[model samples]
Target: MPHLLPDTGPQRTLAASNFTYTVGSGLFLTAGVLYFTQAVHLPAAQVGLGLGIAGFFSLAVGIAVGRLADTRGARGVYATTLVIQALATACFIGADSFWPFVLAVCTATAAKAAGLAARSPLIRHYGGDRPQEFRGYLRAVTNVGISLGALLAGWIVQVGTLTAYQLLIIGNAIAFAASAAILVLLPPVEPEPAVDSPRWIALRDRPYLVLTVLDGVMAIQFKVLTVAIPLWIVEATTAPPWLISGTMLLNTVLVIALQVRAGRNVDSPVAGAGAYRRSGMAFLLSCALVSLSAGTPAWAAGTLLLTAVLIHTIGELWHSAAGFEVSFGLAPKHATGQYLGVFGLGAGLAEALGPALLISACITWGRPGWYVVGALFAVTGLAAPLAVRWAQRRQQAGKGHTASRQPPRRICQTSPP
Candidate 1:
């Protein structure tokens, strides 16, 4: 735990910012939907539709915003996103109708996505020699903060009052504002030296795009614990329904305790690809365990489900670490934000589409679906190394071309969240 602490002032500041941001995220994630459906008295379908529309719109905003961050400045752009997110969240209380709800959600979601891309440069600059490792530390901090916020949200949900939910909204907004405020403590990070490249090079980079698609597919595994596992426990397995919360608690604890440790050794792009393969295999095994729990006795079912969650969480750590390495290690220094923004498109799509895909494959289709999903992950994992190698080769080719024109310098920047 001591080793996991951020060593530098910048790292500490960034970690503090991440912690505050995720705490607010946890609050909203745990209870925001309920606030809309119950406190706002909006229809559930309308809320879902609005969120879906917002998610779709956000996918297109990240690249442009990220490019803005690169040209203008990361800290300012990032702070702007946080302020916009705060404002949009505060507007939630005023959203009575579907259109107003859509407006607020769309603005907030776009800001959130844009913030992630905009902050990439800061992570790269402050992360020192191994930004991926610092990302792991931040992930650990994020899990801890989110867990605390979730506990608070649980109280709000238990209170079950309009005022309590409204308070949750206000608290969430304050958290975002506070997160932005913390960023002021860190020194500003200037944009990297510009390179001669295409206006939208990330979009044109086929190998990187291939890697992005593969990573996006693997990202579906993220929804398994949040969406499929809980639904499976209730609809299929005879495990006590209480295990749903228990499983989530277990996952949170493991992530907070072990995320940095698990990612410590996966330091390079090649290593990250290997981690992806290992993660896929772990997910496959966990899925099998989950599928077997369906027809078991209560105790046996509970055991299998718990075991599955443990394996799944481990895979999640590896998957996250791999993504950080490959995304950061492969991006050009000058276009870190734009490349990461492009990288985010895949995850954005997965976030929007993963739940439906998981439901259809893991729940609607039953046990066979779990196997199908597992196999898909395994195959995706198997393919990652190849994609990474292709990216490496392309990177080398670009480096060679650049060297012919001028003195050689490190072109592949190594950092991002």
Candidate 2:
């Protein structure tokens, strides 16, 4: 037999997906810093509060957008949303007052939410029944975008001009427009059936719900590693900023290289379950590595922190790929957007809470904060295998019950439970 090659169509779709993610990540990288700078003129707490408000809006609107994507075609919705987001990014370039800043952020947030909702479903549609590999590829592309954006933003900031920052935002807008164009070039996606679909029914699926909860919990660690860890490094260690950047660089590189490999052959529920189990263990290890930073000497802490960060990044890759696989697998075909949207809520909540929670943990527990986070990580990690088993059992039981009710002649063969 001839060696089978991956379908050309799906490969093309993956390229398009990567383009979209790159544009989105670049835009976020540019806009986030600029928004923070504008907020910094205000009281410190107020700045934090403003960001929190924006996050709340993003989460709320993201769920609504997901529902809309299910009703409308993901391609059309995504294209429209990207245009709006680009305009919003432009608006931020000229924003001066607090109210204008708020407006800009809200507009951008809504656009992002819509884009994310559409993007997730589109990936699923393009991937057909095997979403894990596609999602992994998407993430790998997204990580590349993030890395590039970070580099660009750092350079812009180092240039030390508000105009330079504005230029970055302009570049981001261009990227978005370019991404929208690329998406338009792709084949149109068909809308899935929406008949008899229950609104927010995804929220009711127990196993999926558990997975989302665990994702949310794990997100706390991610947030800390990205945000709080840097701050800790600056405060407690003699490490230079370059080291921190290096850690992130290494993370992005590893993700780009390994995600597709890790995601390959993960097409079934059993494989997805296995992925989750491994991801959970990785998370536990990451937590432990990060927690060990407290014991290192100040001179050596940077190297230790960097090592820990590398480990954490690996865990992130595993967990993210697994989470996407399981969640997308469990979602109903017709309600893919809504289900992903609902699932995304946990992440949004975590992003909103992670910074404050981590800071508070540090303040309350002192040096042991790292250990507390580690413990949480281990607990959640260990819970994943149990969760996967439970989900499989539940699905099997449901199948058995359904089979028993059907007439022998009328019974339709389906994919395994």
Q: Highest TM-score, which number?
A: 1
lDDT by residue (1-417, candidate 2, tens digit) is 011123657546546546555755664655565545643344445555666788888886766777778888888888888888888877876766567777887787778877887777778777765666867766776776766776777677677576676677778777777777777666767788766535776766788779778878877767766777777766655677677667767877888888777777566656666665566566556555555565567557776777777777777776777677777877767778877887787788898898888877753455677667767866776676677778778767866876787777867788998
Clashing pairs in 1: none
The candidate maximizing lDDT is 1
Per-candidate TM-scores read 0.96, 0.86
Per-candidate alpha-carbon RMSD to the true structure: 6.3, 5.6
- Model 2: how large is the Cα RMSD against the reference? 5.6
lDDT (Cα, tens digit) per residue for candidate 1, span 29-127? 999999999888898999999999999999978998888888888999999999999999999999999999999999999999999999988888899
**Given candidate 2, what's the lDDT at residue 14?**
48
Clashing pairs in 2: none
Clash count list over all predictions: 0, 0
